[model samples]
Target: MAVTGGRAPNQTDSDGRSELGKALRACRGAFIGVGIMSFMINLLYLNGSLFMLEVYDRVLPSRSVPTLVGLVVLAGGLYVAQGLLELIRSRILVRVGTSLDEALGGRIFESVIRLPLIAGGGGDGLQPLRDLDSVRSFLSGMGPSALFDLPWLPLYLAICFAFHTLLGLAALIGAVILIVITVLTEVLARNPLHEAMGLTVRRNALAAASRRNAEVVVAMGMTGHHTRHWSAVNDDYLAQSRRSSDLIGGLGTAAKVARMMLQSAMLGIGAYLVIHQEATGGIIIAGSILSARALAPVDLAIAHWKSFTAARQSWQRLNKLLMILPRQREVIQLQAPSRQVLVETISLVPPGSQRVVVAEMTFALEAGHGLGIVGPSGSGKSSLARALVGVWQPVRGKVRLDGAALDQWQPDSLGRHIGYLPQDVELFAGSIGQNICRFDPEADSQDIIAAAREAGVHELIVAMANGYDTQIGEGGHILSAGQAQRIALARALYGQPFLIVLDEPNSNLDAEGDEALTRAIRSARERGAVVVVIAHRPVAIEGVDLLLVMKDGRAQTFGPKETILGQILRPPPGPIKIAADGGVAKP
Candidate 1:
């Protein structure tokens, strides 16, 4: 099975857990503090019921202004304290959310960067980040407060029972009915909400892809087709959303109606007790207020049920992603590889794919050697280059650098020693100087200029209006294709990495750029760096002394460049004509 399906290498043996759970656990103290505040707030809520009771029973019969004022003053103070505690609890919860984000933001971003490498570039590529946002937003909302207030419902119910048993029984019945509605809402809304979430992800992915390829769609007159496709996806997403909303909304309205009916029933029961000489008239008003307060949390929870469900699903998805791509373990620091790059019978499959693109092929390149890989389209030259540069892992064999496996060193550490310029070069949104130095804050100006000169693009950069400080738009849109390729070459040559791999380095280059690329390759080999170039163009292989020819995912030839090229250029024992596209034909 492909790893993109979420079956990680250590799925069975490793414990399935996420840093999110750990981060939440770290905020246990804040949650406990919030719970304590909720308890106090609930205790203070009785002030309203008790004050009504005193005004109706004590102050009315006695008609004492002083007693009324005293009760009013005490209740007012308690209400202020309750409000303060509530504010503090809200702030604490917000800080807890912030703290959790701060703790996991870096780790989450690292996972996002590596996700494509492990799972292939599919989907929106922002799902994990969105999940974190959902979790944080839910934490910083009223949902958590409602959850915390739920435990105090029994206290209010017990107080109502102290006033009259009949009123307590009525409140209990109403609570039971509301609880059932809450459970039903959860069960019925789950599937619709889940489907809505999936539709949302798909819709967003489509929108993102369309925006990225707008130029293509417009140039090819495909705008209408893409718009209709997006519309269909949007319709499905909206339908799911409307279904979830209607379900939650209908249940929430029912909950509100049931709550009001229960309050009225409490009043009726209290009035009956008063008529039967079992309670005072004050009990009627007091019981109604108490019952409403008792069920308020459940009602609030139901109102925010959608948010709760979204947060729960987001948490689950994030947890699963983290489990699949756990934190990279700390490896022993190894010396910088210096001697040779050994490709020992490696077989490679693309990420998120089951088809092997490169079969078991083996080769070795010693220091001070430059090897060029030549192959037809779909011949796996690029895949082999990916394996050589540690971008793709071999399933069956090892890629060793000076006898140490690629995994022996940390990724960042290993990256510093390998320079790679892919066929399709993309520069970041930064200045030319920053791009060349790999955004190193402490990068020396001399080193940056040296790399540029080595790639033979220093004069072109200096001739620009901003010299090296010119901002390259996202994906280097500001530069021409040839200019971008040369800058990418400079970036690869930066810091003089020991192993350099360039795939189709001259695909977009002019004669000057091609000469610069060849010079850069020769310079790297002179510095004892092992260089590998994968190319289909003839000029790209001129600087290399060794050659490897690939065909049908297998190495068909490998040896000194002259020997391999001589055999390929030699004529067969058949009459043939050289085609205009540089191919021999038997006609």
Candidate 2:
């Protein structure tokens, strides 16, 4: 059997696009637009240097007011155009980031929800959202602009060469030095940044877990212990962040200093050329400007080195995760389940283990029948219930409903026909009516009331302050355990599902609640829905027509309820005995 539910490694879609490629493709047009705008923006950068050259070479030499005024007008026009292009480029990038988030956010959440059911699917659940945010932040920020402008460095260098060969040589050498600094920044910060990101994810997950279980922690007096544990994790994250920041900050400082010195050195070289009568004063200042422009992209890259590494790592991690998730298949229309469940020697193992939880168990239940599965703790009753409801796929044999395999049916379609109440009932934050209606946007009010009445919670709900409109706090914490379980039962019974599996449905029920549960089961059976209840108490199983006794992951007995109960409760044969005092004796 497969160890986990993960897809094969390196899986791809029909068009052969990897998950990373698919995400990037969504922003391709914006990236290209940014590239074009960068080219225009860099070309306009020459307006300032050229204007300086014109002021020194022509306007000042001729002392002509008209010429200077014309140059000023031209420079203003170029600056205006450059600003407009920059604004457009920024807007496009922002749109690209938003679009990417919109495209992938829902898919990532769905993948997270499905991950636990798949084999080999183990990772921080919230990491994908963070990774997506990382990608979006980088794309919309100044980092991408630096990359877009990097290619123009060569053009700037060529301008310096046009002024004088020695000035060109100085600019080229400075560019090489700054490039080395950028590389060093990456090498030094990569590990520290990666470590810091991991710690942040762990810390966030820990904090969320602690908050979710706050009541228990406070009651158990574990608040101090958890606080100290979280503090240690935070300290580790801070240390790694400090290391990364220190390295990037050092490189940024060095790059800035080197760029300033390089400009000065180019000026010095230009001045020497002018002294030799090989270049003019106008060319000297323009050469220095060009040299600064040439190294600006490299400087920006080094300054934003941390964001680059984080984004790169996030991209890789997201790619690996998305690839491992199974590709969504085309939905096939199938008929609804007809309450005929055939469990043909089905076996179930835990998600990440080979140890069987339900072993080679075979049974069949027809419409209008109720099966009560009674077993000791750890006897696999819950596992069998999960298999029956398609939460856990069988490792061997098959579970067929209406002559079709459970896994073969479309999930949403199948879900509409299956009502499952796990041992631990968890209700989401919503109104009582909304939870009962399964949060369906188009849920009919009549059906909601019918389901509540059938589950025997309608009277209790109408007695509340807002009737069906009462708001339940997160996980239904505001309600008593019995209330939550009854509401959960109402949710399961909604839409009159053809098959219902209730695992320990009455675990938290009082006497009234127990009667309500039994009435619900009988009502469902009357509607010809096959009902399966896993129970520990005899009262909970009293209405069941069939009994299945499980022990040690195997079904010990499966037959009529009276026959099985009689056989189990029958007294063992023994030899008759007499009391030593001659009184009647019991054996």
Candidate 3:
């Protein structure tokens, strides 16, 4: 009922018991400290009560009223202190929980960062996992309650046993019974619950797919009907949820029965011991009061085992995720023995297609010289640009930077040296200046403003009331697409790479914005950067550099623009012509 119906991937296992173990140890110390301090307060109250009684019964036989007044003060003071210690214990444990979350959640992010390639989902998995409430749910649902409870349980049992070994033994037996009930409930319930979660992922995926094609859904009037199709997924999610609930209900009832037995036994046995010679009325009172303190943690542990299990599963999944090797043939090692870059034969693969969208493609742009790539839509301009930026591996050719294969470049140093702008731009929520600098802490304000001015966004920034400090909403939604793109360009230029690859840098820009981009590219070139722009329009680069026209993944013409315009008019694959008016009617 998962796939053919509705379900998604449900990976499992944990990093280890070590994380849980460490959390438990810290909680045990905290809870123990609370318990110890509370025990002292309780003991002192008990001792003081007995002392008051001795004074009333013997030393102050005629002043029993004064003795009673002294006992009330002692009891009230210690009671308040005990409550305070409990609060302190909880506060201490919350801090530990927060710190432990750093370990648990931090490791998940570390795994994500180390990966060179992400499969299938593009790493959106971090969104749900990184959320603070989700982390809280994960932490509360799994970590502290289990660790803190399990150890405190035995301490509870020992305390109960002190009142009377028989009563203590009875409570211990009940605890064991509750634990068995909980684990057994889990064994029977886990599989179906996992099934429900799988269905939830499918529902989310279907909803995502539906939203992606909203125009199609609306044009076809398929929204309402397709929405029903989507509801089928939700229906399955609910059904699975019911199955999970029923199984858990069965386990919960069993555990409840065991808990009731323990509660009833603690009362019955304490009462029996008090009536017999084994325990006193005060011992019975203490037993009733302390039973909750001891049993609370144990029950908590059982309740959250699924969460602990899931956190463990998340840890293992992330670790395996990080270990994935990139399928790209070029490794980008940056360590190969090579000096100046002079390419021989170069080839590149296009996105989502085999057939080497670029074939036998070769070019050499010297250190100070610049190269600009211009082509029609499917002519592999972006593919060539990606190869330069080391984003993709050439299927059958080589890309060398400074005479070494591009794969040998160390990623950090390579990125620091090579700036790239992919067609799709992404920005985080931050101030305009921060977005321009891309959160480079070391970037001087003057440098950021300078880059912004060069990218033609300085005037735009100044127009806003907050100027550079204006908040750009998430993904820079506060700005127009062209504005966002220019800011992204500014970020790339600010990096000052030796090579800059711009793919459709003007795709979303207006005519004026396009002019700004053209100026930025020329400026980058003037600054001694080897600029390779995958252009859709005429070259605004000042110099007459060479031009390459591609047809069916092969360069059909390679020469200077002044030398090749006629061939471009009647280019191989025939001339890309327009009919009627001028707007690219057809090829």
Highest lDDT against the true fold, candidate = 1
Q: What's the lDDT for candidate 2? A: 0.88
Where does candidate 2 have its weakest 10-residue lDDT segment? Answer: 1-10
TM-score of each: 0.94, 0.93, 0.71
Q: What is each predicted model's overall lDDT from 0 to 1?
A: 0.89, 0.88, 0.64
**For candidate 1, lDDT tens digit of each residue in 221-338?**
9999989999999999999999999999999999999999998888888888888999998888999999999999999999999999999998888777777777666577677788
lDDT by residue for model 2 (230-339), tens: 99999999998998898899889999999999989988888899899998888988888888888888998888888889989988887777776654554555677775
lDDT of 3 by residue, 1-587 (tens): 11111111122115333433444455566656755654554444344334433453444545657666776777667668756765665566566557656654644454345342323243234433433334345654434545644555676677677767886787777777777777776687667766766676677777877876788999999999988988998999999888777766666667666776666677788678767767655555566556655555556666666565455555444434523431123343444222234454777654344466777877777655555566677887776776777777677768777777766655545676776778888878999889777687787999888888778778978999899899998778788888888888887777566777777677777877777877876776677677766666674443326566767666777767666766668645766778778766555
User: Candidate 3: minimum summed lDDT over ten consecutive residues — where?
Assistant: 1-10
- Descending-lDDT candidate ranking: 1, 2, 3
Error of 3 at 88 (Å): 3.2
Choose 1 or 2, whichever is better by lDDT.
Answer: 1
Ranking by TM-score: 1, 2, 3
